[model samples]
Target: MAMEKTKETHPHTLGECTKSILPVRDALEVLSGKWKLPIIISLMFGNKRFSQIAKEVPGITDKMLSKELRELESNDLVKRTVYDSIPVVVEYSLTEYGHSLEIVIKTLRDWGVAHRKRMMVAE
Candidate 1:
């Protein structure tokens, strides 16, 4: 049976609610946790070495950074590159797909700034 498309005035179906939420849950899963967004923000400026990312996102341990980088790379959001040189060089950069988060990040930043000001005024 074809599911009826409800207008905004109509009550939503269980399937409608689940469909809406599932994608957001998946996005949050990929972007979740304390260090992931911070790492992404650091890489947004430019590519960096692992140590550089660790420095930029203060308080994240080397282990956590390494783990987070691996996850991001696995998700195809971050690219890891290696160079054949005197000493091996590894760099991390956001993939073009990752760069797609630019607007989302900016919107979050704006909301954060506004929320901070709102909270201050409320206090």
Candidate 2:
């Protein structure tokens, strides 16, 4: 299936475009998970082993990490590579489609920092 281009430079932001798609339903479907975004963000840096990803993202259990990785792979957002050697190794990396989310993640992070500062100043 052809991936839809969600990015627009016009009057509306991607969130707005997403809203126009299905509003509550589609948004929830895309963002529904505790660890999806975190996992995606972690893989943005580059390919990483399962253990490395677990270390980079705190508070995620091995089972949950594996599950999340599988889901991401199924969604085509992440690619899994296996290496053959004395000790086999596997790594996960974001696909080109996943790289498109980098800007959105960075924007969200920036907004979060600004929001926290504002809240702290208000207190």
Candidate 3:
């Protein structure tokens, strides 16, 4: 209650805080879960087939991968291409919008490495 009063006093600060939170929450909604980031990272290297993505991410079940890919595709973060030829080839790659995550992913990788080192040092 006190904090709400304080926030109300600073309308600009409250608006900024609320504005940032919704997008962050929405992003987390799309990127949450164990497999989504790994799958996205895999596609970052190059376009790949379903089996290839499975190989890269590792430990992810086929059903989960398919589900994740569909979600990613729906979000316009991944592009799925179907080639009409022998065996009907399909490939998955990052969309232009998806490439926007490059810096965010790099920052996460750096943070993860640092956190691991910090934990090891603490123990």
Per-candidate TM-score against the hidden true structure = 0.83, 0.76, 0.86
> Which order, best to worst by lDDT?
3, 1, 2
Each model's lDDT = 0.92, 0.85, 0.94
Candidate 1 vs candidate 2, lDDT winner: 1
Which 10 consecutive residues of model 3 have the lowest summed lDDT? 1-10
lDDT of model 1 at position 13: 53
Model 1: runs farther than 4 Å from truth? 1-12
How many pairs collide in each candidate, listed in order? 0, 0, 0
* Candidate 1 structure quality by residue, lDDT tens digits, 16-114: 877889998999999999989889999999999988998899899999999999999999999999987868889999999999989989999999999
* Candidate scoring better on lDDT of 2 and 3: 3
Model 3 ranges off by over 4 Å: 1-15
Model 3 lDDT per residue over 7-123, tens place: 365665567678888999999999999999999999999999999999889899999999999999999999999999899889999999999999989999999999999999998
lDDT by residue (75-112, candidate 2, tens digit) is: 88899999996599998999998888788789888999
After superposing candidate 2 on the true structure, give the runs of residues whose Cα lies further than 4 Å from its correct spot.
1-27
- Rank the candidate models, highest TM-score first: 3, 1, 2
TM-score of 3: 0.86
